[model samples]
Target: MAMIVQARAADAGAIASLAEEIWREHYTLLLGEDQVTYMLDTIQSEDVIRQAIESGTVYWLVKEDGELIGYVAYDLRESELFLSKYYLKHSFRGRGIGRYLFDELKQVAIENRLPAIELTVNRENTRSIEAYRALGFHVLREHVGDIGGGYVMDDYVMQYVIS
Candidate 1:
């Protein structure tokens, strides 16, 4: 059985390693090697992840049969849950794991009395956009933010309203 467990600060290094592997395999084509490397070093490094966790970002690890296969990270905003990161191993795709993780997010929203869950998806990442749509998310708006290194994230801000 796959279970979701809260991640601790000590788990930051493991999450960083998984993020590198996942981004290289899945995002290199869309983001190119240079941007992926830059984002990894800046946003997904172990120190950064540890700081985020220490600052109250909630992280959950997806463990299946004692192996860590994926992670979800989010923060509770005044109005909604801000989903910062959601990634699974390439081989773990198409196994309903994404839906499993999403169900957990929904529960978090309910617990926090948040009205919705929001996340930004790269505009070029059609696969993820479609999956989010299937989960009842809608494109709230477009966003293009410079993440330094002369690269920008051109993404669609999406929201899933909870009932």
Candidate 2:
């Protein structure tokens, strides 16, 4: 295991690459290639990343020996923490990076004195649901989020009570 670093604005490209890989490897199967591409192109745009940093949404890149392998992007809303994006390089999956990332994010939520952490995951993604359940998050409600056009994020809003 190598020490990981939470990257800053200069690390945007590395995190963007990780985001693209995550979109392709994770969402492409469920959402299809075009949806994945649209998401990557739009959400991972340089301008969008710059805006994220400017907006104070903390983006962290996991680096080992100076090589980027994963990243997490999240934001705080009052007393709640929202996890928007969390992923590892496709090749790095199953090596405990996802678990570590989640743990770290949970800590972030706790450290900020947030009452709970909330997230939305596609209802069809049982793997992610199971993972969240293992980490003590419970489904709160089912809602469909429109990403754009006919693409919608059919998700279960899950929350983890930290305190």
Candidate 1 residue 50 Cα shift, in angstroms, is: 0.4
Q: What is the lDDT for 78 in model 1?
A: 100
Leading candidate by lDDT: 1
When superposed on Cα atoms, how far off is each prediction in RMSD? 0.7, 1.7
Model 1 / residue 139 / CA error / Å: 0.2
| Model 1 lDDT tens row, 113-133 | 999999999999999999999
Which residue ranges in model 1 land beyond 4 Å of their true spot? none
Q: For every model in order, what is the number of clashing pairs?
A: 0, 0
lDDT accuracy of residue 55 in candidate 2: 81
C-alpha lDDT of candidate 1 relative to the true structure: 0.95
lDDT per residue as tens, model 2, 1-163:
6345755677677677767867788888888899888878788866687679778988887876677777777899997999877667667767777777777887887788888988889998898889889878999999987888578888999999985
Q: Estimate each model's TM-score.
A: 0.98, 0.90
Candidate 2 regions exceeding 4 Å error are: none
